[model samples]
Target: MSVLIQYYNDFISRSADPRVKQWVFMDNPLPTLAIIAVYLLLVLKILPLYMKNRKPFNLTRIIRLYNIFQVVACILLIYMYLTAGWIQGEYSIGCAPVDWSNKPNALRMVGTFYWLYCLKGVELVETIFFALRKKFNQISGLHVYHHSSTFFLTWIGCKFVGGGMASVPSMLNSFIHVLMYTYYYMSSLGPEWQKKLRPWKPRLTICQMIQFTILIIHSLSAFHPECDIPKYFMLLYLPNLVLIFKMFYDFYKDSYKSKSASLNHHQREKKIS
Candidate 1:
């Protein structure tokens, strides 16, 4: 394990952008890991106990505002990514690489990726909101891990590979969130609007699953020795994307497929009775 740790550190050091070396959390992941640990501890253990005997907070207005903010943030990111990296097809789907220099366009690309890292911190409020509402069921392992890992991995992206192909996943993720938070915003309006919007929910999950698939494919392509993207980053991303895809697939199966099957079974039984 220690040998592996040293190799991993060496890999990151080789790939990291020299320009951003001094940024917080850019030099190492230990600080980010510490923050995630505290957040998990609070949400999963301490806070739940504190809220156990207390009334759940009615945070509908707060949730609505958060959803709106997320939608706006995602939209802005999409625009920034377009202008910085992908507009006019500047970045090919599978082959954009880190711009190691400090030109203006390159700096825009780097800043956009770093901005995503910052947003991941804000997204932590998602878990906290669930906790505040006493919606413990929503705070699953998948939820916490997704929030935590994105923060860490994106930090790695911004710190090491901040241009070219680095922007792909962030752009895709922002696009997905635009749809996702719009749905959330509608649902927060109450069951009436939620019912009208219900049809879009599974579509959102499907989009998320597809987003993971695309990331896996794009990153996997970078593993070819000829690609300018670093081999180690692709190596790290491929497995991680596979894991996220599996998790989301399982979620879709349980949340949508299983529920549909159970509902059909109940309908058949009722007819028989």
Candidate 2:
């Protein structure tokens, strides 16, 4: 383990810019991981055990506010990314390498990247809300894993490759999340509207799968001999995205198929009667 840490330190030191130290939490990785660890523990173990015999708390107002906040934050980040370098006049469509120097635009982009990481942490509340509401069944492995992996993954991107090609996926994901949070925001309205919004939820997952597919391709393109995007960052992002895609797709298939089958069985029984 010490040998592995030494290797990662050597690589990150050489691969990352000195300017990375300027960002909050960039100098120390452990605290971020620890926060995520505590989050997982609370959601999976401590909270559930505590909430077991209690009445579920209604988090209607809080959840709705959270959804709106995420959407607004994502929109702000998207706009900043476009102006900072992601737009046509500013950055190439192919790949943008890390801005090792701390120019103003680079600093803004880096700050937004950090903000995105923090937002991922805040999004963990989604699962916690479920636990609070006693929707424990919704807190599946995929749900927990997705929330867990994103914090570390985005931190890696910011710490090592802040204002570069990786931000593309970050931007794309923000766009999807705008719609996603919008769905959640509407669903938080009430059961009547929530049922109306259920049809849109699957579309959100499909969008997520598509985002992962594009992200995998984008990360792989960095490996082209001409591109300088770090293999280390790609190493962190690509495999995890592939796993995410599979998990989401499998859940979608199983869910949709079961619903269809049950509906068909019920219809056939009605016809028989």
Candidate 3:
């Protein structure tokens, strides 16, 4: 245990981003880990038990506000990511390395990324909301896995590689969230709105899959010898991307493709009749 602690301290001093270490929850993994653990405990156990005998809270207004905040926050993150480097072309989308200097753009990238990290934490509230509303079915393995994995991974990214090529995925994910939360906000208006927005659900999943696919490609491109971003980062990140991509693909297939196939078979039977 002592040797492992020594090694961990050495690793952090050698590689963790010094600038972000002072930021809230960026000082160490403990705070972030605690937050995630609490989220899991509350949403998966405590809240469910608490609500077992109570009526589900009607959080319609709260949901609308949450969705609106998500949309706005995501849009702002996209712009922040752009100004940090991508907009002025200071960073390469293909294989940009982390800038460790105290330069303005570098610091900006770190700031933007840290906020992105915070946003991932904020997203856990969605699951909490689900639990509060007693929408247990919405809290599927895929849903929880996606939320938790992204939160954890983004923390690692901020701690070690706070910017550069990784920023591409952050920006793209924010863009997708803007679209996603917009749909949520509209659907939260009423049953009629949900009916109208229902058709777009599969499209949202496809967009998520596309984002994951792009991240996989982006992670692969980091293997170039000239790119200073550590190869180990890709090693850690790429496999997660592949796993998430596969999960999303499975979800799309199970949710949309099979339904379409079944509908087609029904139409064919009707014609035969």
TM-score, every prediction: 0.93, 0.93, 0.96
Residue 237 Cα positional deviation in candidate 3, in Å, after optimal superposition: 1.2
RMSD of each: 2.1, 1.8, 1.2
Tens-digit lDDT track of model 2 for 42-77: 998999999989999989998888888999999998
Question: In model 1, which regions exceed 4 Å deviation?
Answer: 1-13
lDDT score, candidate 3? 0.89
lDDT of 2 at 83: 81
What lDDT score goes with residue 82 in model 2?
Answer: 88
Q: Quote the positional error of residue 30 for candidate 3 in Å.
A: 1.0
Clashing pairs in 2: none
| Model 2 residue 27 CA deviation in Å | 0.6
Per TM-score, the best of the predicted structures is 3
| Candidate 2 residue-wise lDDT at 18 | 65
